[model samples]
Structures are given as structure tokens and as C-alpha cells.
Target: MTKPRTILVLGGARSGKSRHAQALAEAMTPEGCFIATAQAWDDEMRDRIARHQADRDERWTTVEAPLALADAIAEHSRSDRVLLVDCLTLWLTNMLLGEADLAAAGDALVAALEDAPCPVVLVSNEVGFGIVPDNALARRFRDAQGTLNQRLARVCDATDLVVAGLPLRLSGEK
Candidate 1:
């Protein structure tokens, strides 16, 4: 069986990366699964999550996998469906906070993507463009995010950098 396309969408905050990823996934298949990596830790975050949920219609199925992202991808992927992973940075944060092995988690995620039978659109923040963080923890997170983005970019069939709500193809076909 042929493996479907995998796209990596990278951008800064509010850069419309999620919207672009969603559009790409929806275009591939009407029946889609939204693998959300965000966890509502506060009222503001809950509101943000609600707004994201509001963007999708009845054709989408929502699954939260803030920590078990690789397992979610492996189990939810199907030959006739598309899977949109909205924000990998959040998943990384969850792993960091939960004291999980970052390298192992990343390896498992890459393996799951390689084994997926359907199209996958992954969203992530381009967090390395700003000034260096003032604290050690912040710096570590930033570095990890950059490394994760680089690794996923290499695995993805297409990588797009979104700026000011516009997408620029960084690799693969346009």
C-alpha cells in the first residue's frame, strides 16, 4: 500500500498555521480526524480551544492527545481519512512538563508518521525567530522546539513556513 502525503506547517503565534493545516487536511478528505495536542489549563486556554473546535464542522472528529501523540496518530490514521495534528509545540510542552523522554517520544512520533496509511498535516510554531530567552528553561524549550521542527521537516513530504497568515513553501512541491 502507498503511504499518503505528510505536510509540516510552521509559523509564529497567530500566523494562521492551524488554519492552513486544517484546509490542507480537509481538502484531502472530507472525513478527517483532528489530533489536538493542546490541553486547556485555564479559562483563556479553554476559550481558545473552544474557538478552534468551532472552526470544524460535523465531518471532523476531535481527539486529544497532549501526551500520547504518537499513539493517537498510529491508532487514528486510516487509508480513507486525513489526520490534522494541530500544534506539535504543545505536545512537546506536555512531554517536557510531564517529564517524558523527549528523544524517545520524538522517535516514536516519527515512526508512527512513517507507518500511517493516510495523509497527515502537522502544525508547529516557528519559535526560534525571536530573541533568545532570558531563562534556562525557556531556552531549553526553544532549542527543543527548533530541533523538533527540523526533524519533522525532514520527515515531511512538504514543509511550509507561514508568515502574516501567508504560506511560503520551504520544501517539496508547491
Candidate 2:
């Protein structure tokens, strides 16, 4: 049996990461799942989430999971399915705010990907390329997110960095 293909997509805010990832998933898999990790904590966020929902086609299966992303991926991934996680940064944020075990969660997610029965597309924000933050919590979040992205990229079958609405494949492209 062929191992499942895993693609990790990374970019800064408004860098077209989600759009590129969605297109890739649609082109690669007839059966697709959209794992959303954002929670509408405020009006602005609610509107943003609604817009995202409106943008998706009816063919995609949407799962709202701010946390337990690994479990959600495990539940949805199958030999014939393509799982597209919209963003990992938000999931990480949720875990951090919830005071969940970050290292354990990260490990579980990586293990889940290794055992996934179907293709997986992970989306994440590139948060470490800008100026340093002024607060301790912000600095910690940035560091943690950067580390998480690096670890996942190392294990992904392919890694892409989206910039200015274009995807630059960094690895595993034939």
C-alpha cells in the first residue's frame, strides 16, 4: 500500500495559503474534508469565519475543531479522503489558551499524520519572520508556533510556502 501524501502549507497573513491549499486539495482528491480550527471569539472573527464558509463549495465536508485536531484528522482521514486543515496557528492558539499540553499535543498530531490512512494538507501561518514582540506571552506564542511549523515541515511529504498568492514548493516535488 502507498503511504498517504502529506503537504504542509505555510505563509504569512493574507499570503494566500488557504486558497492555494484548497485548490491543491480539490485537484488532488475527489473526497475532501475541511478541518477548521478557528473559533469566533468576537464579531470580527465571526464575520471572517462566515466569509470563509461562504467561499467553500458544497462538496467539502467541514469540521469545526479548535482543538483535538489530531483526533479530528484521524477520524476523517481514510484511504480515499483528502483532509485539508485550514490553519494550524489557530489550533495552536486554542491549545495554548486552554492550557493544554503543547508538547504532547504536537507529538500526538505528528504521530497521527504518520498513521493517517489518506492524504493530509496542513495550513499554517508564518509568524516568525517579522519584528520581535514586546510582550512575554506574544513572544512565547511566536516561538512555539515557529517551532511547531518547523517540526511538521520536517515530517511532511511536501512543503510549500505561499507568497503573494503564489505557491513555491519547497520540497517533495517531482
Q: How accurate locally is residue 116 in candidate 2, as Cα lDDT from 0 to 100?
A: 91
lDDT at position 110, candidate 2: 98
For model 1 the local lDDT of residue 28 reads: 88
Residue 70 CA displacement from its true place in model 1, Å: 0.5
Error of 1 at 123 (Å): 0.3
Listed per model in order, the count of residue pairs whose N, CA or C atoms clash below 3 Å is: 0, 0
CA lDDT of every candidate: 0.91, 0.89
By summed lDDT, which 10 consecutive residues of candidate 1 come out lowest?
1-10
Scored by lDDT, the top model is: 1
Global lDDT for candidate 1? 0.91
What are the TM-scores, per candidate, against the unseen true structure? 0.96, 0.95
